[model samples]
Target: MSRGPVDPRLLQLSGPTRRWTAVLAVVTALRTVALVISGIIVGRTSASVITDGTGLADHRAALGVLALLVVARTALAWVEQRYSHRAAAQATEDLRVRALTVLAHRDPRTVDRAEWRTLLTEGTEGLGPYLTGYLPALMSTALATPAVLLVVWFLDAGSAIVAVVTLPLIPVFMWLVGTLTAGRTEKKLMTLGVLSDQLLDLVTGLPTLRALGRLSAPVAEVRRLSDRHRRSTVEVLRIAFLSSMVLEFLATLSIALVAVGIGFRLLDGSMTLAAGLTVLIIIPEVYNPVRQVGTRFHDARDGIVAVDRILTLLTARSDGDTTAHPGTTGEAGGRVSEERDAQDGQGGQGLTVTFDHLSATGRDGPRPRDVTGTARPGQLTVLTGPNGAGKTTALLALLGIATDGVTGTARVTAGPGTGPRLTGTELWDRTSYLPQRPVLDTADATAVGDTSGLSLGQRQRAAVHAELDRSRTTGRDLLLLDEPTAHLDTPNARTMVEALRRRAAEGATVLIASHDPLVTAAADHHIEVRP
Candidate 1:
């Protein structure tokens, strides 16, 4: 929210990153100090040899201390990298755990499972380079650049002034190039997300596509997506190249300015050899951090997108009502529950579901088109369609959850005397919809129990049994099941169909979307939806 270089929420949530970032700052500061001291010793030692007529014999202790300083700098760099990466790992783990908690409570219909999976996996992993490489570089630039500049000012005021004049140039170029580079990186991640979504959908429906002998269509689609991804990659690389060139050009010029100024002063005898050499030696330190910051800024952006995603998920919920469903209760729901309680004997008997010229269009073309059908109490309605024929879409429309584009009506009658016309979502207080897949990982909160460890047939059987028992216990007015018998054995499927028949016989409305002949043969009403 603050739009700072480091997300404040990220630091608050991840202790390791907060702790290590502080440590990295301290280590970088000490490293810069050691670097400056080494430069001074080198300059003084060289001056003693030439200007004072001295040799290595006069500077053994200084040289030894310089060697130790070099070792210290190397060790500090290692610590910086190690701690940064370690903190990154900790942050990724911490945020992912929080995201998982929120995702578990989220309504399944609101998000794409494929996309969430991608973000939690690849998106989180992308943070590695940002934390390990870019962050440390940025911290070093922030702390070391100014510190070195002040040191140069003490050693040679003229060189420091030239540096001061030229230093702002690198930042100016960085600002210009950074804006373009950031846009490029964002587009790159967006394309990657799109490609991932398409690939997951392709894999999930690959079997059906193969059965229809339409594999070539999906292959072409994949190729098209890959080309888009390639184009995005090329654009990012192009921007990266341009950014590096511009930053390099500015930094090199700034360094040259300082070096040239220092050289002139040395020749004019206005500056001592030792001070000039020291300033020259330490001047590059001023620009190196700025240069590294520009280059690594691009690297860090990939993780910025990921961090935003994680934060959004975590922000969607509070600590209460983790299992609360929108369908569970509302003013509309209270009315349905009260009516059901008063005329409890009806048990959804004599109800009617009518769709007249019903159709809905999704982001894909028409989900289902020109449908006219009815499901009455004391009868089971079965919807039959081929893969991608929009049977599921029709069910979604009935539940009043179809996204945005609505063309016609799909309504339900709640009571025997046509008491009220309600969308299934409004009547969801007494509607049981068993989707094609399990909605929640934790089954205790759902009508469909956890079937994670069960075999395919066993899973279907478990879900079907749980939903049937739940319907009977709750006296649900309508039962809508999608592929309820999928992966079910003959005996289990037969048992499930018979149970549906009994529910219809007892006066509950039953609707199913399936392709099995056994299911269709038992239906009192059958609706065929076209693609």
Candidate 2:
């Protein structure tokens, strides 16, 4: 599906963010108040001295007072940024956590590795402006612009009238300019996404590409994407420069017109010099808010686009199947409050994972071959298959990660009186899947497994063992491995196999997917898939 327009629904989706936005609203209001008050004081003092033609009776006093207020304004600005950044970081964290939880439960077949990486890594980071900058900007526009105009109206009705009437023209021009490049902006963002995906693939496959003498092509592609990004940025800046010129011209002209009228009024003895000068000075101050809004509008536009993607990811549906068994939450945290009912007892059942008649097709390829498998307690079932023979797909189906293209039902069954069988996340608690290419979040290195002095193989084994330990402690009872030996040498693979079998002997169901005969030979049950 094509990327759709940014919907206000992003702001509406998160209750916590909306509530906190009220806090930002207060901050923005204060910002507006400070801006308007400071502007008025500056305008009034400058006009008073200019119109009165007075020298320094108390110039030092006035300068010192204005300096103090300026210092206060700067302090307020600092505070606003401090709190806004804190709030933005919190909002980003909340959205990222929720998105990741949803992603963990999603069927991997539907959301590929590239998409997940972009959404998780880039999408969350891109949403900074919405909470910290744009939200406050919109708030200030709504709160301060009108009040500033009212002050201008009180200072001089004629200038105020013109300022108020012409102020909306700034937003209108901004929208017009922004619209002219909206398509280009979106196209650029998409290009960046693809570039990001390509760079990630290249980095991950760098060793293989170098071995095969294929590194130059990826390097060329990176250079091309970078050049395109540079051009897009240049185009955006050109538009920005033109838009800024328009705002400046309009603001200057509007203020000048007010000054001319006030000049005529003062010469005609229709108003005091002080009052006419005050009105003249306030003219520019009135349009200042509108001018700021126009500039910040672009940031808000990008923020909306980023937030649209974030909300889409968060709200997408996923099949809610977990492998946790009945008579308990089947959750990893072990908050189950009740013992299994007598009828729920699954004597020696341990766990039974069955994938029945599953099939999937890839991008522009033949329909996926049918795959079937089962894993039972006290037994090690190894699935041996060539590349693309559906071994990984089958494992994912059993793990509930390939639900998108799964044509038939898969179920995890427990013996009688073990409560109803668990599947999905419940099953997840009872199982640990070590993918062929594991993507571990390094943010919590200690939580996944200790990494000190460990080689790649040791790290992988430690992660697997850590999951096993965590499961056993949390009342989980199954483990699944995809290509457990793919990246390891013969010796390390053999060692891991022995460790895996020992876990099986301890009543954990272990299922291994591999192309190596060594892994299959050690298995209590072996299922081979032929292309």
Candidate 3:
């Protein structure tokens, strides 16, 4: 399949960036023109002094004009640099936002946390050199190279012909080298991602590794992976340096050919000293942009690879199934009397959750299959099962969260006059699903206690309590808790169960996945998942 252009998409995402880049490109072209003009004037003035002994006073006007052009060129260059960097910064921000949004919508089960982290943080950052340096250089080349060559052609056709003949070689060599090195560059990026994932896993599991006395083996493995990554990076750099050398050689050789032709013409009186000098000045200007682009391309290759990966992730879909919605009424039994007052016009009516032959395939373990259960409005439903019985999977499937590779009929019914049926979004709007491992931020840590000094159970209790308080305050209609008591002690577990029971009594449909007898005994309803 044909792939779409990558760089333009970045520009399309940031309108201001596109405008700024256009301005920068124009300014760069004007700066190149001014530079060539100033070089030509200097060359002619020097030639005149050497050949005719012209007084410096005679060239004062030209000197003043050259100085003005120099000043203008410098100013333009400054503006170009400013706008180009601004455009690049905006483009980077747009790409990061888009990538994060796409990842946020993706099913968590289908995503690798470490890989996504690398992609979002380090991978997105790789675009800096590409956007700010390589892209602007490419634009300058497209605009300035031909314009300078045109002036050379008018001044000295022979030199211009030499330039035109050899100028194509730089890009040709670049393409040849790029084609050869593209695959390796992509492989290097993948290797870096793998290395990052391995390191993150090792760091996250450090305590467990130390407890089992198996830390040395994993540390050694990480070192081996790090060595491999280093080798791959060095290989990429080597290719980049080699490519730079080849391009430099081609550009220099081309400029030398132009210089030799100009020298011969100057000697034979076929070209005037002034025109020869002008052609000489324009020769290097014609080739410099392309050389710079060739050098910068290597730096940009990683960003190109990252763009492709992020685009692929954005285009991909989760499971190919739709979430089901069921009918409901506000007058159902166990309805909360103060629900209207608490909600204050928000939709906080309890939902009747139903599952029929629900099933899901785990990403790495056994999943619940052919499971059937229901949690009525304003009642606490507890899901109990042995390890690996897919109890958590069942809860996730019911909430339509990370349902990739999952097939099931799970529906939510809202109260009468609330709606015809509650779709996933509507249900999710009124629902809170606390996963097995709740991610606690700094604010949560501060609210709970000193995270560094707290044990696993303490942290879990803090997160659970925070969510429980949120559910009660916000009047969320549906609460899904997975292994809420997994790290809590007996007292804390009982307290959490009582908290859930109170929310159910107050008008929320609370569904929990737990192995604790305290939680199961306190539940208004219990659904067991078998292996």
Measured against the true structure, the TM-scores of the candidates, in listed sequence, are 0.68, 0.82, 0.86
Give the C-alpha miss distance for residue 453 in model 3, angstroms.
8.1
Q: How close to the true structure is residue 466 of candidate 3, measured as C-alpha lDDT?
A: 82
- State, as a TM-score between 0 and 1, how close model 2 is to the true structure: 0.82
Q: Per-residue alpha-carbon lDDT of model 1 for 1-531, expressed as tens digits?
A: 225677776776677778978898899889989999999999999988999999898899999999999999999988877777788898889888888766643433456666567677777786788788777778878999899999999988988888888888877877777676666766766777788988888887899989999988878878988998799879877887888888888888888888888889889999999998888898999988888878887776667777877765565454343332334221211121212222334433456776666666655777677766888878899988887777876776666555335456666775643556543235676788888874433553354444455666666666667777777888776888898888787888999999899988888889999988899999999988877
lDDT per residue as tens, model 2, 55-143: 65646676676677678767767776887777667767777777666666555555556555555555556557656665555566677
**CA lDDT of 99 in candidate 3?**
70
lDDT against the true structure, per candidate, is 0.75, 0.65, 0.73
What is every candidate's alpha-carbon RMSD to the true fold? 7.5, 5.2, 5.6
Q: Please rank every candidate by lDDT, starting with the best.
A: 1, 3, 2
> lDDT (0-100) at residue 92 of candidate 1?
86
Say which candidate scores most in TM-score: 3
Clash totals in order: 0, 23, 4
Candidate 3 ranges with C-alpha deviation above 4 Å: 1-6, 14-20, 315-348, 362-366, 416-419, 439-462, 516-518
**Candidate 1 overall lDDT versus native:** 0.75
Candidate 1: where is the Cα deviation over 4 Å?
A: 112-118, 313-484, 492-531
Candidate 1 clashes between residue pairs 3 or more apart in a chain or in different chains? none
